[model samples]
Target: MTTPGARAEAGTTRFTVRSPRAEAVWLCLFAGEAETRHAMERSGSDWTITLPGDLSGTLYGYRAAGPWAPEEGCWFDPAKLLVDPYAVELDRRFVQSPLLATFGEDTGGIVPRAVVPAPLAPLPPEQPRFARGGLVYELNVRGFTMLHPDVPEALRGTVAALAHPAVLAHLSRLNVTAVELMPIVAWVDERHLPPLGLVNSWGYNPVAMMALDPGLCPGGVAELRRTVEALHAAGIGVVLDLVFNHSGESDVHGGILSLRGLDDAMYARAPEPDGRLINDTGCGNTLDFANPAVRRLAIDTMRHFVTHCGVDGFRFDLAPILARGPGFDPAAPIFAEIGADPLLADRVLIAEPWDIGPGGYQLGAFPPNWLEWNDRFRDDVRRFWKGDGSIGVLATRLAGSTDIFGPQRVGEGCRSINFIAAHDGFTLADMVAYAERHNWANGENNRDGHGENFSWNNGVEGPSNDAAIIAARRRDLKALLGTLFASAGTIMLTAGDEFGRTQQGNNNAYCQDNAIGWVDWNARDLALEEHVIALSAARAGNLRTFAQFPDPVVWQSRDGKAMTVEDWERPGADWLRCSAPGTGFGFTIDRAERSVNIDS
Candidate 1:
């Protein structure tokens, strides 16, 4: 198949786009305020135009003409500026407007233009820097460095900020194997957010798959490539968190941004009678993986990052949607397709592993080579620390979730990315500081985030002035962090979690791009940060032992007696220690004192 999007040649550039249902497609180029629309010739399902002169850095977009039936999934309005699906750079960020939805309203003034990318020599294929069963640090690029004082003011809140010495030192201190960056791709604010004076802090609502968001990554692909190279120099890998299940174009009432205007069939639809768009991702519309064209786009997007940016791997948000052909198929063709692609075959693949669709909760359903975000580990660990969970269940999770991933465990290479908290939920500090979610600021009447967080405030609900309450919260935080570091698997630590960063109890601060969302580096808990540093160093030194639950292990009581099944199953059993010979490691969890002692 011919590569889609603009390709610069010796003296001319060839532009291609796939709009099978469109009767006609035109390539619109921008020079200053003037725009030129060149009609493209159709060959099969694709539209092409070979323009005179190398058009690198030129601003361009597409306008397709076709049927406008939204119900049957044919949205092609020439007035709507369509971003190239394979675009790697954009002149500006996306914004929401009602004009984007109204037919023939002319969104040329509102929509962003895709920039013709300069040709880059692909990186020599090398083994990924990330290793299995290593610490995966998750972070939002903008939020992570937005308020960092050490980062230059000019570079704050951008991908370039990640290459700062301060940021590198922090990641190195955590002994991070890979930094799983949250969505950095171009995304538009949700329609409801502008009215509320809020913006999407999380880039989950993506528009173009390959284009980097200008706000977050001002230098485009070059900025990302530079950052990745710097991180590699620091012995840290880079994994992008990509959203393939849905697009920011949203539902029928939403905008005709890119694929929707070019090829509406790019989205999955319900069985004919009504033919409504599938809402599997709960992000309005689900990208149709069943369509071969869509699969090609997904694969091509992965290749672009790996070849151009030299990223170690990707973490698929709402990954179950990748396998859904209306129903979840364990043997989805995408799994085999990615495995077969040479550029992506060795790249680390992590899956969120669930969506809102039927059978979406496919915990251990991904291919063996892929690592899955273990939400079970999050909830069960939270439950145990909250004091209502079973020790046996906690033990299973700490032992690598053998029930979910099959018995060939972490000792061999665990498939679980264990975490007690992630970006979607409460921060690790809030888990012990706020019993209930305080998301009143999200403008959804305090009802936007998860209600049952399995959280427990020590004494007071929000902040506390009492020294005892403060001490207790710190102890609980240490216990939780210790449990995570001691767990058997590739553990993940969300940025700012090493120190104590809070959203003022906002479990879902996805829209708070301000101080409420930014990490308060000035007010960080230094002691907690040091504790995490120690844990990270110990985990790195004893990685072989910490990667899996030790065999020939003895579960002992506080008195050092081998614990019986009765002791293991005892209700309110809070303390236990485990040790194995020759591994040079042992650990004790004493929930009564809110502490975890790691000996390695």
Candidate 2:
């Protein structure tokens, strides 16, 4: 239980924190532009101290002095220096300041300090190189190596430019089992994006929760443990995506940083003169995983990224506000304390489930050993390739959604992570070229992203020097990367959507940190990245029948018999198929010949 910030040891260096209504909490430190503070000692909802020698790379933070009463949540600003929700490292980045929401406003030069972190050792507990139906990808470590031309303009956009060997040969030519990233922690920049000069380039507005974002991980947890040991020596796997449902100290007029000045009941409020904090992650607040000290700072920030940066699991962001004790509990005691944590039981978790609160659309309601971000398989595979859906909802999202993850977990192999385009919408070349949401450079005039993006435009909407509308947007992006590699499960793709990367139609470029959030890598589309590396070598040669829902099944139509429930509700039926033939696997699709034809 002794795990809250600082640590160090062998020459003294303890620190701790967890305020539980601070009436005092000091420990400030710093030394460069000199500071000091000390005075901790609470022990009962922690405060501790120890100090003497080994203050490893020292630069600490935290101040706390209780009750300023953020309407009842209590933000106690000892002139706000806070940051250290077990901050694994942060000595900069987290700018936005009205002196971090003013009040006594010293802000120690506007926040960001917590560095201490020098104890290394730990990475032995193996098993999590990520496999579960392979191919996850996602990305955004500074928009995937900020326009990487083999990443070395001083390691272009950080996380050590994803262990670059041209980013591990483009994630080993997309046979990537798990990259996911998207929020290399330490975020901030969302107080309406610095009054629209804009900035949160998608680190999803975090703030410490296990640091690592000295501007996209500047060699921190040993540069993410040497890029997870060089993506486990190129067999891929990192994961992350994090945002434990909100922090970046946002809501009640935001900012006293780090768990909102060390515990505004670590967010999640409402009820009682409308105490008001729970925004359920439209990112304004919400992070009281029913507070067992916010699930022990989310299981010690997932065991400091699996014992100091091995990291092979966690996607979470707005994941039904971690089974909301404020409402949505598919038996959430933080999912049995992360399935009784042994460094998070076999890791891989994933979720992004849903959360504008209330029933918060919990797709398949998490915990069947997690993994779910199937925005109903991205709006029924973009409304069945934008021809207005149904070939029975694209054969229930090409066989695995099983009506929102049921039918015995889609015949025993599905938690459904399928994707039609992510990192929050539109690219797969702007969902076949932007039917809407251009975002007016996100000043919020085109009212920010996703306005029903079961998108379309194929005839010519955004960029087109018109070679037949860029060959019908690369033939609807090779029929949406051949219906996300003939569906089934754990799919995902996002990072430059296999070589097309266009935020030009800005599906909320998350405050476009320049070049509309990087990744141009010389205008990619090497024939749609060799058709997503031949659909990741045909889903790695049918990885266990694309990880489930393939077995003696048939489902045909277009005259090869079988299919009828009136050919999955006829209306211009388009065409269908689906074969399994005891795992030779299948596909076919057509949608009036925009084609997809996979067949293992």
Candidate 3:
């Protein structure tokens, strides 16, 4: 196979590919009304082809002829057209199409031919100014305003909706200082979803770390810039949830996406003991940060976000995986460099400090200046207030979890990111409404979500007209919010938790891209929204109360009893009065007031 008049030159428009294992490869191009098949030339393990003019907006795929063997991770069937991992533009949105197949031998033999367009436009200027001590609301873009009737139908799913007056009004009223939009980077549905008639809603499986998903940015970079500027004008910051721990491309058996094609050796492969790919992320393959080239790629991606997207911060998904080598170490070179980098050092760096890898739990081990998602705080507070445990764990968590975070690195004066629920799991409403996970919609039976929810259904599995259960659920929600705000650390709230959004007991609603996960603006409970607003107001009114440095909060129980270590361990002591010595305010709570007291 050979491409006629194909040559490599500085200004020449030609693409090259090489697969020693393939007998032939063809470049299939959608040129006007007809499909043109051009044979590609092979050089060693590479193949080459060239187009006469710009191929912008032209649909293209590749065909490679080779044997198919399912067991050994080689499924090369040239009959299927492969998407280019580095294609800057996509011709179609990802619909549930079986026509898109993953099984192909010589998968790397084909590439999505790059579409030539006018010279790429320069990115928007960065907005570096951000308000200090701002409350950040973590939300899924599609879930935040997608179902709201107030948002224009065309703008609902795109970045344009974020700037709509209705959306801005909601954020302004809630007094959110920042809106940490979940991963909006270009991503793909997990391979299992299309076959199951499901779609990826979380955007965690990113294919391109630098580019925003076109589907979400219909108006492109200009629209995203407007949204960011709108947020900034309203005194709010914008943070992005980034997933550099791995790519959408799974193991060798997965699709041939970006990183896998640019350089596979840069990724972490199973060690010499097995020589397979390490599956630390549970999503199939773990990125090999051990390789310098991979490290550079990750750093470059971060630079792109900071330099181009104007993001004020980044919340790293599966951050612990980024610090792992043959063993887990908090002081890994990659993390240390990031902390020292002038561009990223001062930016808000939050880590989801655990992965499925060995010794993956590094809860409080992240370096100074880095905030970690306090899962321990989330679990303990839930259990204690829900009447399941001694208050000892809650006491430790409220003080920033010195036990798990270790007194050495994260003393009583460090800031921890505390939250009860995030986008990955159940909403606050479902936490108290279901004991068992109802993830049947995910097509993996009921095994797709975590089995141990540490949740109590309050005597009902889901929605109920019973007054007692409803009241208890509401109180619990308030309590959870209160506890998060009162804790001696930074607090974060899931977007719809304030108004009581429920996934109907589904803890893992990652693939339900519809109403199950979206916020219902029409059905929002005004009273509850007010309660959440009041909580935010209280926090804003008394920032000193939650601050950790300078002095620790001193408390005394109502019966003239000091809150000793033993008092925390005691299971029967429900009503206790706590006082912040330095801040002049004291509050008391039995089990019922825990919701409002802590949140407010």
Q: Rate the local accuracy (lDDT) of all candidates.
A: 0.92, 0.81, 0.70
Residue 391, model 2: lDDT of 77
Candidate 3 C-alpha lDDT tens digits along 321-360: 7777756777788887787777777677878899988888
Report the number of clashing residue pairs per model: 0, 0, 17
Checking candidate 1 for backbone clashes, the offending pairs are: none
Model 2: pairs clashing at backbone N, Cα or C within 3 Å: none
State residue 258's C-alpha deviation in candidate 1, in Å.
Answer: 0.7
> Candidate 1 overall Cα lDDT vs. reference?
0.92
Residue 73 CA displacement from its true place in model 3, Å? 9.4
Q: What tens digits encode model 2's per-residue C-alpha lDDT throughout 80-113?
A: 8888788788888889887887788788887889
lDDT accuracy of residue 100 in candidate 1: 89
Q: Using lDDT, rank the candidates from best to worst.
A: 1, 2, 3
Tell me the spans in candidate 3 whose CA falls farther than 4 Å from its real position: 1-89, 94-134, 406-413, 544-550, 592-595, 598-600
